[model samples]
Target chain A: MADHEHKDNEQLGAAGFNRRGLLKCMAWAGTGVLWTVNGGVPRSLGLLGEAAAAESHAGGLTFLQISDSHVGFDKPANPNALGTFQEAIAKIKAMPTQPAFIVHTGDITHLSKDKEFDDADQAMKALKQKVHVIPGEHDVADADNGKAYLDRYGKGTQGRGWYSFDAGGVHFIALINVFNFQPGFKSAGLAQLGDEQLEWMEKDVKGLSSSTPIVVLAHLPLWTVYENWGWGTEDAPRALGYLKRFGSVTVLNGHIHQIQQKIEGNVSFHTARSTAFPQPAPGSAPAPGPMKVPAEQLHSVLGVRTVNYIRGKSPLAIVDTPLSA
Target chain B: MLRTRAVLLGGAALSAMLCAAAPAVISGGGPALAAAKAASVKIDNFNFTPPTLVVEPGTTVTWTNADDSPHSVREMDGRFKSAALDTDDSFSQTFSAPGQYQYFCSIHPRMVGKIIVQPAGKTSSN
Candidate 1:
């Protein structure tokens, strides 16, 4: 691993490129690529080698994003969802620079059973960092309409497990969009943030300065992506409208189970991969479900994301490393 | 367990009747016997097979999930709602009254279905 990291640094040095040249030549250099934003333009800094090492030592705030663990899922796609989730935890435990915390975007269980929540909790207990979680639709499937999820994780949260906090000079807001799923109630057949949560969010950021970097975390995509598959949120445009005053806003979501990113004005939206099993790309399959890939390639398609924030930097740096890589 | 066995036997009997090309006389059964008439809805590839099912009153509608994802059967008017059904899992609802009921998979709302229960003694419109 050290040799690979060294080689990556050597290639960049050999190019004898300035910052502008590096930005122009930068392709998505596979796994471990660090993405930083400057003037709302994202640049991929290939490989997490010297640059990441320096940032870690410089006291930057780094965190992990793990989503869709689906702890009770035991299907052909990936027979041991819990096992893979634990493997992701192990990877985070072994990171060279420990992250400050972890934000699990949701789907923490398959059926929202008590035992499934217990199993996922036991596995997550292995991580040294505190975890911030929002419920995926699966987590709230209990007969009581999410009472089970609220019992265990609802402390300090408001209105169906949404809350905000300040971390590393960044304002972090966790929203819940996987509710209000009664029959005939429709949000274009997609997830929704609802009126109460939207109002709370508006007041949540009222005191923040325009320069404050805001990170919005939810279980579903904040923007519409493949409406037929329910991959996007219905009222996300309204929620996003509130953040327009902020100079830098990053919305992190997880329900899609694959990485899809979009940039609009000063906002950047990113979806993370699932730790349980991969789903087909939007509109690629007959429907959106656990996508069965070649058994050998499963690990490569499933992994975690790391985000680093430096105080003076305009936007946070994001690194996505596959488990196999 | 008894309910499951009864539903299975009822399904078998229904299939046999259909195979024999007999007139569907699914009426005039006692309370115990009335619970035996079964109609099925198959959930595969995120869509309900036989999306619109018309059956005689007192027929039990069973939804079987065949896809890898989990789905729940919930009526639009909140008459009945099932827990999440994983692959091979099934949920059954007995419609005693005659009316049209709309339902959808609460997990994936895009997948919708309908059930119409006509007055007793009428053949299934299907």
Candidate 2:
């Protein structure tokens, strides 16, 4: 560790939530982040330190994040997306410890087809853990405006399928930002959470104490990663305002189809890798889409994110393990 | 700052190496046109190549998804709308009236493009 990092860790003291320490080390690792929370403070560790992170959190609560499955997609970038999805499930089954649940951060299907949804659901059944899902553009990008997605997954969610739940002392919020594509330009603008969802979010977290750790799951990035590609949420600043009171907030997203992390004050933003294919990193290509790699090297860029939360610790340790790795 | 520089550099290469050229369209249709003239806009690299296009009335503009990501073409006014387009998918709209049509990608608001329908004799110079 560098001298400044050491000083930053030391400054954490009783809080033990070295935000800067973790942020400074947030280099884009092909592997995911491992998060650990101690004493209501969240701390992050890289993939190299997953074992240590797991060992310290002996009986911690863990969850998995699998995103951008694109189940029906069959293209040069990934001819057999379903096959890769099956591989992703196998990886989850092979985990040393089973996660409490799995949160799929949207793009469950390629064209929101019924069979695509069914195939994705069946593939996910290989895992024993419970699964929570939010819609990605591909999941709800149909003529019905997500009617199919809402019918299957919007059981307890609010308008368009935004919902929150409390599990093991952590508050989990699944938001739907893919609901508002312009009537004509279908996929041109940034994702929108709309006013109704934002108002509901404000009231949903109003009662929680400031120390409560919050995990926000959505399909689109709440922060501005790339405006030209609509890789961000337009009303995210308002939504984030509702979470500003909390000591630790972690936002997990999919859509960009790559692993990227950002830290700002109490909130940490993370976009996970796709389970089926990889997209060019922001500004790396002409536009964001499936990035084709050598056939054998495809799995190296696609993987699942595992997040572990240790009670009383503010930081959530995230470990992103690629399927091939 | 570094990332911005990189993106700018990439933008330079994108224009030079990629196909954002204007599509050719033969002009000769009357008010009661039988076969509409055809032009195309390629949706690649998160942009509508030839961000602005000029065509005569009775022209059909097709937007094709050349990139792997899905996209849709929507007009600002309630004139045309397309379903989400997957890779290699396409949508076409026939413009009959002579007017300026402004549109954007609903999923990517920053991607704005315009279509100008000139009178029979006029051509798009801008």
Query: Per-model C-alpha lDDT, please?
Result: 0.77, 0.74
Per-residue lDDT of model 2, residues B50-110, tens digit only: 7766666778888998877777776664366676788788988877765566677655556
Q: Please tell me which predicted candidate would have the highest DockQ against the true structure.
A: 1
Runs in model 1 lying further than 4 Å from the true structure:
A1-30, A49-57, A181-188, B1-34, B121-126
DockQ of each: 0.32, 0.26
Please give the range of 10 consecutive residues that has the lowest summed lDDT in model 1 chain A.
A21-30
Tens digits of per-residue lDDT, candidate 2, A43-103, equal 5544434467557446767888999999988988899899999999998898778889999
Instruction: Name the docking class for model 1.
Output: acceptable
A-chain TM-score, model 2: 0.87
How many steric clashes does model 2 contain? 43
**Model 2, which residues run further than 4 Å from truth?**
A1-29, A37-50, A181-188, B1-34, B122-126
